[model samples]
Target: MIANKSLSRLMAHVTPGRLLSLGFVLVALTGAQAQETAAPPPLAGGSQDEIKQFCTNIADAARDQRYLLQKQDLDKLQTEVNDRITVLEKRKTEYEDWLKKRNDFMKQAEAGLVDIYKTMKADSAAPQLQETNPILAAAIIMKLPAKQSGLIMAEMDPKKAGVIAAIMASAADPLTSKDPS
Candidate 1:
């Protein structure tokens, strides 16, 4: 009963302003303590300088590992490029072989055509040559014996024969032929 009376007397003496001030003080102390605990603890054994030295020691090793990985990537890219080049070379060789075969076939066909024209009479050959491409007609005439070519030209229309002759003359000596602009 005496303790209760003393607590009541103490409460009666404390004003609202004093109680508010006490509450603010308690809050401030609690905040300060929380801030102190929030900070990270220092390393258990190593000093700051030792930790820095350890990081420095590993720097070169880390850089070398990174370089090795980059080199591996470059090597893989180079291998791919080489493989593509090899494939392209193979394709080029195949194309060259096909071109050669085609050229050989064309030459044989031209030769056979010349032979057929050689056996034909000028009257029969002239009309056919006139109907043919001028370049091809000129080529055929150039390949024939001079006597047969003359006979064929004599039998052809004058305009057609002149054009064929001009083509033959230019083909025979391209350097000397004047461009008929």
Candidate 2:
């Protein structure tokens, strides 16, 4: 056949070195083509589709677990807030009790102070009361009999007596007189 004759002619002209080089070139080309056409190895987990399906299956459960964790954190925060509120309430109760006891003691001390002032001479009591807190002096004077209060006021410095009188007036009518200052 004409093709066989041409192949024979081509083989006859090709040298041994040329044939060896041609074989190498062919092998190189074939290896490159094979590499291009071959599929990459599958991942350790599985094929892409299987991995995608696995992730899809776990998505809802993962989301639920995340939400549960968030809820637990919120619950813990709420409990801490509640505990702080309870402690605040306890402190408030203690403060109120302490204030009430302090007020009761002040009232008893004020009564004893008034009794001492009542027995003293007006001149002696006036100087002592003036040296005391003006508010305390005023309270003592108010508790004294009207005649004794007048005697004490008559003996006090006019400016101090006037300040005490204003305090007494304000105390008497708290709604109308808010502050002596």
Candidate 3:
């Protein structure tokens, strides 16, 4: 009760907009904490293969995301966002067809990740990769086609692009330090 009184007093001094913002932050933090604390569902005793299949399906879905992005025009920038969504639909259809024909869904998923990596390397090297800012440079490095890294670097400010490019190039290496965040 005393704690509540202090908190209410503190909140009272905050502007209405600030109070609402704090409320939103508090809600988000509490929700995330609850999710982290929630117990996992009990696993079925004999569903190992089924679990593998489920994971395979999810990875395959992820591959379609990359494929669809690849087909969309990145040069048009703003207009291409709409086209990318359409490409994603096409990729989904292709993934579904593959899943039906081949029982080895897991292999397909692994191959898709490799394909995405190659695509990113190529796109980032492309001469036309968007050179808007360090943030966009980082974003493009993830989805750019293989061989476009050089192009992104050429278009960007030397210092900022160089640092990000080095990070991109070394991502294949094992992590040397834990993520601070």
Give TM-scores for every candidate, taking all chains together and pairing residue i with residue i.
Answer: 0.59, 0.59, 0.23
lDDT head-to-head 1 vs 2, winner:
1
Which prediction has the highest lDDT against the true structure?
1
lDDT string for model 1 (45-81, tens) is 6587798898998998999999999999999999999
Cα-based lDDT for every prediction? 0.93, 0.92, 0.65
Which model is ahead, 2 or 3, in terms of lDDT?
2
lDDT for each residue of candidate 3 in 9-91, tens digit (9 for 90 to 100): 99789999998999999999999989878967668866878989899999999999887887564546757776898899999
Q: Which stretches of candidate 3 lie over 4 Å from their true place?
A: 1-136, 176-181
CA lDDT of 39 in candidate 2?
A: 66
Pairs that collide, model 1: none
Candidate 2 lDDT by residue in tens digits, 1-181: 9999999999999999999999999999999999978967658755878989989989989999999999999999999999999999999999989988988999999999988888999989999988889999999999999999999999999999999999899888848755422
Q: Which of candidates 1 and 3 is the stronger one according to lDDT? A: 1
Candidate 3 has an lDDT of 0.65
